[model samples]
Target: MHFNFPRTLGQEDAKKRLSAALASGRFPHALLVHGEPGLGQLALLLDLAQILSCEDTATKPCGTCFPCRAFDASALETLHHLIPIVKNDRNSGSDDDEEAGPESGQIDELNESISLWHRHPYGYHVSEKAMVRTSQARELLGRLRFAENEGRVRVVVLPWLESLNDNSATILLKTLEEPPANVYFLIASDHRSGLMQTLLSRCLHLGLSPLSASDFRVAAETLSQRAQKPFAARLLPFAEGSPGLYVELLENDGEELLEEALRFLSATSDWRVFADYAAETSPGAEGMERTTRLLLFLLRMVRAYQLLKATTPANAGTRIDTAEALEQAGWDDSLAAYLGAIDAVADLQAFAAFLESAHRAVREYSKPSIALVGLFLEYEGKANRSVPA
Candidate 1:
């Protein structure tokens, strides 16, 4: 099957610059691609790799070329994929368990993960513990120092560069400083704030903004076809322009969660409905997980509501003209009713703060149910107080 990357979804300017870089043979040795999670960083990296390795002398990445076919078949000799691994807590081995390298089992598992990612990059949610350890970095350095096997340009694709540990960072920094003749590094990360300044200074940095609504719609169509599932119109508000996050939600039964979240928010003005939902969802770990997802959806909605609130006219008084605000924000009718239920900016802020706190408390506290129940009760009291008689 031919796996395609959705280039039009976002990052138009970045793509143009990349194309220019390729056209000019004077591209940097290392590139740091930073963007929010689910913004197609890895897919862009793979696209660059394919472009660099394409054998066709004419149009770049003529997918029919030998190197392009090899890439599609997962047999590309010039490209290497690197991922991080953390300490295995389940091994029950001694601390001195020789630095012999990642176990064959771990390597096999990681390779399998990479293969799945190749098939569906956006659908493949990255592992939480995928951190690049020192040994892995050392091994990568050794491989990159060697001459290319194909007698062509070599590429090392590094995603989640922020996960690089101190030792690994040191080794990578050395590599970035020195000259590797024909090798290039393509690094992708979610958060650039955590990356080392020295490392940032060594490479060409390209920052990708979140996707626009129109672009997201186009992307949703492509993702829908790839996933073989019907697209839900409700996902736009929840996705907040992140296609990767949207795919993640889809994998996690996003349609059901969206329905539940919208229902919960709609019931905000009614105590009985809110109470019933709390009773059902504040019972156990599984219930808490669902509650957490609902709260995350709520947070996104509040953020959007806040955007709508900001555009309201000051002379419009305490009671917001919801229609006018929606018009000002260019929000579609889908979100009008749901957002209108939010009485005021103060209420939305308080609601959002509560959701964040509740999410944090559930993750941190031992008894999540108790914490969440108390949280909902408090929010209910505040929400009731906010309503006019």
Candidate 2:
């Protein structure tokens, strides 16, 4: 059926490879697509699943077929989805019970989520706390036990498979090891390391890379037009070539986050100021989400500074001499100015590492105020040691 793929950039190679495999009748029954969270892995997985279940042999997804129409309307009987959901203890029914599916409210939420994702895959966001539970896995397994039409394909699309808990993963692994006839599993994961090795071995793996700058620009521009928002090129470097992330930044207060990141850097010049800023922006449990986004912006700046230092001629002597030089190197105006003012390349490198450590710490429930204070103290110590008496 006539379907519009998400306006994600790049992955042409991946599309070609998948199409070739399908054409040759060598497509893997369980295919695992892994990449960074915003690299469009889910979008690609959905496209592949739709193509696999298409009724048209000549054109594949000939747009007018029943399967194609069903898919478009999200009513395909053979197509299924397994998405992460908030764990509900009260709804924990026996695995053997056929009626122990998600509650009607959960089902409504799931359907709405899928609908929104279909409209704008890149812009969709799943709650970090949601995960695939054992009950959901058991329900899906129950559905698969029944026989299907001969020669008809049934596709199960699972996005964020990394969210599958240990018990749920074991349930899925059993099926992946010995899947039913004419069934395909299209799985996508943002964090491959979180997945079990046994599960990894059962699927044909495809890794996707971040989009190129040109492709990112095209995707960003398209999203901007559809969103009716002004395109902010300065946020491009922060996006690190992920259109999903780019869209996220655009929709969220990305510009403000960048500005706050710059302010944090400026505060580094004075211990008292830095400490005050740290205290003010300290992400107690409630602010952790915004703090994480701010940290990403800071990390992006640090990396950009590192790249600028690495690429400049040795004669430049680790100093970004002018805004013009940074601009020439493709930095936006604000970022160029910030990079131009920095001379401590070594300190920035160390700070980048610290930022990474802090990011992990915050995600692991460490106090963000302590992390922020630690950053200031560490940088101040480095600054003091580098200066002449």
Q: Which residue pairs show collisions in model 2?
A: 1-63
- The lDDT per prediction is 0.74, 0.75
Pairs of colliding residues, candidate 1? 84-131
Single out the weakest 10-residue window by summed lDDT for candidate 2: 1-10
Q: Candidate 1, residue 256: CA error in Å?
A: 1.5
lDDT of candidate 1 over 255-329, digit per residue (tens):
676567667777666657765776677677887788778878778777766656665757244666667777665
Whole-structure CA lDDT of model 2: 0.75
Which digits, one per residue and each the tens of the lDDT, describe model 2 over residues 274-357? 567656666466577666777777787776666666666652654665466566667576666556444543466567776787
> Which 10-residue window in model 1 sums to the lowest lDDT?
1-10
Candidate 2 Cα deviation (angstroms), residue 265: 1.3
